[model samples]
Target: MSEADFIARLRGIATDPAARGLADDVAVWEGLVLTHDMIVEGIHFLPDEAPQDVAWKLVAVNLSDLAAKGAAPLGVLVGYSLGDAAWDKAFADGLDTALRRFGLLLLGGDTVRVPAGAPRSFGLTAIGRAPEGGAPARSGARPGDQIWVTGTIGNAGVGLAMRLGEIEPNETCLAAYRRPQPQLTFGQAVVPHVHAMMDVSDGLLIDAQRMAEASGCRFGLMLEAVPLSAALLAVRPDVVDTRLAAATAGDDYQLLFAADPAKAPMIREIADGLDVPVTVVGHAGVGEGVVLTHKAQRVPLPERLGFMH
Candidate 1:
């Protein structure tokens, strides 16, 4: 079955309100926010990548979920697939550095040895203290709310291309592909002002469509309004195709949110105070799914929206 199909089936068993009908990135219960993410060799990361970077990616991705929910991380339980002794040690060192950097605890976990030569895989469950107002849900977006995204889109996708030697290498793109920084502080600060929020992991377009669907509204996105970094523009021309490619490229762990237009000044103020760049990419409407436009002209949806499992 497809990922959506699998989730639909599992929803029956995950009836708790915290499950968010299996429609959200994290589960919130009591006063805590919980999320789990797994990465695998050759899929989530290049096989030749360093163990340290891999470990960091594993941790950052899970925390990205908490960041979307405006949660302050508490700790993590690791699910490790044992591999070479030296590699495992390096991963542990990297994990220690990441946990220290984020002020998170290494609670406890299990380790396993997979079959010989199997791809290395790791999982992490991150627990965090929910924001005082409560964690935001993807289903909370409302019509007339403006859609905002943190940071630029498609840099990580470009980074992946750079890693594969398809494009010239640049530190900006390379680092983005290797190490994605979750917008935790921004997510937390902006939560009270946002009507809905989520981290863009799968692609901007696909994730936006999900938020729109969950919230029972339509998202009208302006292609030109989708932010592109100077580093990305240095390599590719400013064109619709480039914008579309960036919109559909996954692995951008930036926050995407919706808020009242009246909250624009406050949102901008928060972003300015944090020195983080944010852009108004779209607005919620009284329909379903996502609609795109460029230079005021309608654009058909791309056949492939983003990464799908």
Candidate 2:
């Protein structure tokens, strides 16, 4: 089937009340909203990547955004570029697995084909509802708040490196890169106590800068305090600076949040209950820029802390 034909078939199956027939306007809502992203072969994923992994990643990335806002996944609309029948079946199988695992339903979407020799692309639009009270915003953090991260950092980036054969793909490293488990439960647990929150798609340094900019506060990150997975250390034993670099590399789907220091014990308890480690990496200040301190000495911040357009 051609891309347009696929889309027409998908349109016939779509049932999202918020989509309004996919007329192409930005979706707006009071307690919920819609967001979409597109990933292209040779751009988002390597041409030879597995169909299952690609499908999983497409859904997981969108869920990461919803989790950052403390929202629940409602459903998703998918747009796939037409491929051969065998490839399409594999993609669908992968999508189904991810959707079932994440409690997300495939509402409906279009599929089409690009011109020959053009890069193949896939798009997904996710609809999510905010928490009962309200979703956490990137703008709500305040000075005097403690910044915390859920789980270890750098796993996904390390995994990607291994996948590219930059390093050996030991079990640890491979787990980090592929099949990143989004901190959905942890995000929900921290929502009530957190003043601001976001998933660590980009490196912590960059994402922290974003929170600071959005909330009009300064962030002080303690370099020694950033958490690293056992996998990262296993791969690069003597690299003292690996953690710092990981803080700027994209693709870790953990949550970075700010909460009152007084709530630390409770937050830790919550993390323990969820079996996810929570680490206090820094504090938010009244200043304007993000600062990194190593043993009380200020370190030079990276020019680009994370992903940049």
Candidate 3:
């Protein structure tokens, strides 16, 4: 079954308040926020990618979910697939470094050897302490709320293209893809002001559609307002197609949130204080799904919104 279909089927068995109807990524139970993410060779990462970067990606992606819930990471449980001895050793070292960098503990986990020549895969389950007031939910968005996104969009996707030799290499894009930084601190600080929040993993457009659907609202996005970093613009032009491509590229771990229009000044202040750039890309309206506009002209939805399993 498709990812959505599988999740839909599993929802029947996950009928608990903490499950949040399986509409949100993380499960909030008691005072803990929990999330699990997996990265596979040839899919989430290139087969020839460095073991250390792969390890970092595995941990960072899971933490990104916790960050969306405005939680402070506590620890992680790693599931490893045994492969080459040297590679495994490097991955372990990388994992140790990542955990230390994030101030997280290596709780415990399992290890198993995969079949010979099988693709390597790794899984991490991250646990975090939820924010004091309660974690924000993707389904909490309401009509008239302003939509905001942390950091620039499409850098990671562009980075992937660079790795594939599809574009010229740039340090900014390369680092973004190799080591995605989750907005943990910002998420925690902005939780109280946001009506809804989620990390942009699969792609801005797809994730936005998910939030809109879960909240039973419409997202009216302005392509021109979708923030693009100077590094990205230096490589690509400032045009509708470029914006669309960025919007659809996945692997961006930045946070996308909704808040009251009146919270704009406060949001800006929080972002300024944290030294993180945030942009107002859209607004929630009384409708459903997502609508796009570029230079005040309607734009058709792209056939492939983002990566899907």
Candidate 4:
């Protein structure tokens, strides 16, 4: 199918105000909104992976970006690389499933075929409306703000290991990589109070460092306090270094946020109400480097904390 035809098909699926036909030029609402993400085969996923999972992931990854910004999903535009007709249908079915699962709709999309023997790639451009007034940005974190992460880190990393056969696939670990739940509800619940917020896609340490750099602050993480899933513990009980690597590894789509000290109680209350685990990993300080304090001594951190170019 051609890109225009794919888009026309999507236009028929859902109708939303933001997605209504535009005459080539249109003015959008102001504030922090709109997010786009692309995933390529071999880089983001294996070429032999299931088409349904790939389709779900394409949308989920983009939605994760919006969730990090505390934005509610408005709609999506899919950009696909054409393949077999049956495969394309499966992909569309998966995309529809994700859209309904997240209360998002497919506005439009484009599709194109890659040359034979070329690398495969797909992209999803997600549009979202910032909550009420504005969306959270990485530059908003302040000194003394406590850093917290929703759910356990490193599950996706561990799941990747399982995919590579470096580790055995367990129910917990495989679930992390295959179906990551974007913290949309959590982001909305905390948007009003968070000083700064971001989703931990590129590992906690690296993403946290990025947040620090953007906010002109430093982050201090207590290595002992970082949370790990039971599957991770079972695989490598004494592998502190592996845990640290997972903490810095990419693909875990959980939210890492900072908030004022005064709002700690409220944050806990919200987490409890939502039944999501929130861990206070560290604190933001008035400096420019990420410090990992372990056993009262500063540890030499990894040179590349997360995904690197």
Candidate 5:
């Protein structure tokens, strides 16, 4: 069975409304937002990847969930799989760097050793406080709400291509893959404005589809409206395929949100204050699924919207 299928099997086992039927990324418990995320060495990161980068990814991904909930991080509890002294030390340095970079604290954690040659795995539990307007939900989107995305869409996808040697490495693209910046302050500022919000850790389209499913609305997205970084466009030709790839690529860790049309100016101001890029990619409508368009022409949805697992 698929990982998603397996997760669905566990839904009824928990009754807390905070769990959101296992639909949202993080559990909202009163004023506290709780999340746990796991990453595997071979699956989530290249085996040769720097320990520091892996550690940073581990922390950043979880914090991104908090960002989606419009929460201020309080601390983290890490579950570590020890490799060697040198590797663990490097991971510690990376973890310290990530914590300091985000102004977070390490509350507590445990470490363990795996069998020889086993793929390294790590998990993190992040605790955060919801914002004044309360934590927005993936299922809160209303019809006619504008779909907004923070930052450029496809830089990390390009970075992944570079990491896999499919494309030559560049500073901007490589940095995107190795280090992702979670939109903490921006998320907090947006909580009061957004009807629904989430972090784009998976490909933009897949995550957006999730929002659509949760919201019970049709999302009409303009292909040309999706933002792309100069770095991504420089390495990839400006074409439909490039845009599709960007939409379907994962690991961007930016925010995807829906707000009323009237909130555009306020949203832009918030983003401007944070020095983050925010764009209106589409709008929600009184229907289901998603509709794609390019230059006012309807296009069939891609066979794959984004990462499945």
Candidate 6:
């Protein structure tokens, strides 16, 4: 079964409200927010990819979930698969770098060794404290809320192309794919102001649909408003496909959020304070599902919004 379908089945048995009805990325209970994320070799990363970056990606992805909830990370428990001695050593170094970069600690973890030739898989469970205002949910968006996104989008997708020889490697694009920085500070600073929020691990379009579904609202997104980094456009042409590709290419860990239109000035201020770029991409209304538009004209939805497994 698809992961979403499998999760739905489990939701019937999860009794705690902190489970967030299996809708939100992180679970919240007793002022603590918990999140777990797993990355698989060949699936999430290329086999030749540096072990350090793989380790960082595993930790960063989980921390991104905490950032969505505006939770301050306390520590993380990791599940690691032993591969080779050199790879393991590099992963350990990467783990240390990521933890120090994000001001997090390695609490404890367990390790196992798979059969020879097995792909490496890693998981991390991050524990954090919800901000003073409380953890914002994915289901709290209301009608007439403005949709916003932080930082740039689509850089990582281009990075993947560079890695695959579809294009020449540039430092910006390569770094984006190898290391995704979670917006930990911005999430905490803006948590109190947003109605609903989540990180864009999946494509912008897919994740927005999820937020719309959870909030029971219709999200009208402007294709042109989806931010694109200069690095991506420099390698790829600036056109409709450029924007659409970024919207549908998952892996950018930027924050996607909903807020009141009146809060735009404040939101801008917060972004400016952090030197993070924020843009208004759309709005929410009393309805179901999402609508895509370009230059005020409705556009057909892509056959696939993002990665699905």
lDDT of 1 by residue, 87-189 (tens): 9999999899889989999999999989999999899999999999999999999999999999999999999999899999999988888888989899889
Model 1 scores what on Cα lDDT? 0.94
Q: Predicted candidate 5: what Cα RMSD to the true structure? A: 0.9
lDDT to native, each model: 0.94, 0.81, 0.93, 0.80, 0.92, 0.92
Q: Write the per-residue lDDT of candidate 3 for residues 1-309, one digit (tens) a residue.
A: 887788889998899999898878899999999998888898899998888888889999999999899999999999999999999999998898789889999999999999999999888999999999999999999999999999999999899999999999899999999999999999999999999999999999999999999999999999999999888998999999899999999899999999999999999999999999999999999999899999789999898887775
Please list all clashing residue pairs in model 4, or write none if there are none. 3-111
Better of 3 and 5 by TM-score: 3
Clashing pairs in 2: 3-111, 3-112, 3-113, 7-110
Q: Which of candidates 1 and 2 reaches a greater TM-score?
A: 1
> Worst 10-residue stretch by lDDT in candidate 1?
1-10
Please identify which of the two predictions, 1 or 4, would achieve the higher lDDT against the true structure: 1
Each model's total of backbone clashes = 0, 4, 0, 1, 0, 0
Worst 10 residues of 2 by lDDT: 19-28
lDDT of 4 by residue, 1-309 (tens): 786677667767635534323211111246435666788888888877777888888888877877877788889888899988887888788887889999987898888988987766887778777788566667788999999999988888888889889987898887788777888888888889898887888789988887898789999988777888878888867455866877887788998898999999999999999998999999999999799876556877888799752
lDDT tens digits, residues 1-309, model 5?
677777878886767898988889899887899999999987889998999999999999999999998999999999999999999999999999999998888999999989999999999999999897789999989999999999998898899889889998899988988999899999988899999999998898889899999999999999999999999988899999999999999899999999999999998888998899999999999999989998888888899988765
Alpha-carbon RMSD, each predicted model: 0.8, 7.1, 0.8, 7.9, 0.9, 0.9
User: Which segments of candidate 3 are over 4 A away from where they belong?
Assistant: none
Candidate 1 or 4, higher TM-score?
1
Model 4 misplaced regions, further than 4 Å:
1-32
Alpha-carbon runs more than 4 Å astray in model 1? none
